[model samples]
Target: MEGVVVRRVIPSDNSCLFNAVGYVMEHNKDKAPELRQVIAAAVASDPTKYNEAFLGKRNEEYCSWIMDPEKWGGAIELSILSEYYGREIAAYDIQTTRCDLYGQEKKYNERVMLIYDGLHYDALAMTPVESAPEEFDQTIFPVDYKRSIGPAEELALNMAKDAHRKRSYTDTSNFTLRCGVCQIGVIGQKEAVEHAQATGHVNFQEYR
Candidate 1:
């Protein structure tokens, strides 16, 4: 991750984010044209919003607090670009807001790990601490890092596995499809099963 630059996103950087959207579309060529247009609109309007919407669509709480900055302190939108597998990737465009946990502890570093834990998936680590020591301070807090996974299918499978593992005993056969095409599952009971049936996908097996 050396030479990797993490900077705040600005209106001027929209083009770069737009290119990232293009890269995503090109990578997931099987995605529907209408879905691509909707995504393009979101990306073109605001990369931060696009990122939030994407996460929201997946039902992730990562970006759900963007609307209320008061509850989560200030919000920051950032983009990370790096070279992987001989290609440059828009590693992440995360929107994070700080929250004061109910604890007397100070000067403690909080770490959060996001595991793909799916077939052909990748694992990512996020922390509230900045990677650069010089950038660490009281005013500046690293909320979260938005790491990119490969494709929609991989993302879906990962989500599905997580859903199943979380609720194996209760309604193990039901789940919600977060991403329409991705088919990311969220375990539920009868409601989840109905949702899956509505989506026309019934493959709910444990992650190997």
Candidate 2:
């Protein structure tokens, strides 16, 4: 693998899965409704295939719940989206740090990468990404949940975390105020100024 890079950050709201997929595919936030519709429609159209056993709810009910902005998406939704888009969905499962590409025909070369960190799903893409890891290197990663992660992969994940921490969450400068008090994004300039106004610590940097 060349390297991993973040293309976008979907909000941490419950609608994150749909929003993340939409952001990755369309570079915007408007496709969630359409994606949800496709998932619900597909599920409703075939109850046997997407039954309560698989979905944990009646087809119609699951469809309804998934469409709600508050409901979270999972493997079932991911499959539906992959089929609807006719593109492979690449997922970086954060718990295992395993990158799995999901699709049937493998006819389309285009792919959408999503990162699932147990609680949240985010959009991300890797550099020099291949259809499979072995396509670039001979390493075969075991998917065993009980196994420990290797040093190199662990380092890569740590590096990704550190980089994300250093980078601004928002690309737009207007939304972020880099505080001179501390370089990290948690406290914006306005907050810094407010603190200064309240206490006399007046060092601030406009990040935008």
- Top TM-score model: 2
What is the per-residue lDDT of model 2 for residues 13-55, given as tens digits with 9 covering 90 to 100?
A: 6778888887666665567777888889999999899888888
Best by lDDT: 2
How close is every model to the real structure, measured as TM-score? 0.16, 0.58
Mind giving the per-residue lDDT tens digits that candidate 1 earns over 1-208? 2122122221222133333222232422122333323433434455555555554333234333332221111112211111111122222111111111211122222211111111111112211344743232111113223322223223333444554456322223343334344456555445445665678644443322
Alpha-carbon local distance difference test for all models? 0.29, 0.61
After TM-score superposition, what is the CA distance of residue 84 in candidate 2 from its true location, in Å?
A: 0.6
Lowest-sum lDDT 10-residue window in model 2: 134-143
**Candidate 1 structure, TM-score to reference:** 0.16
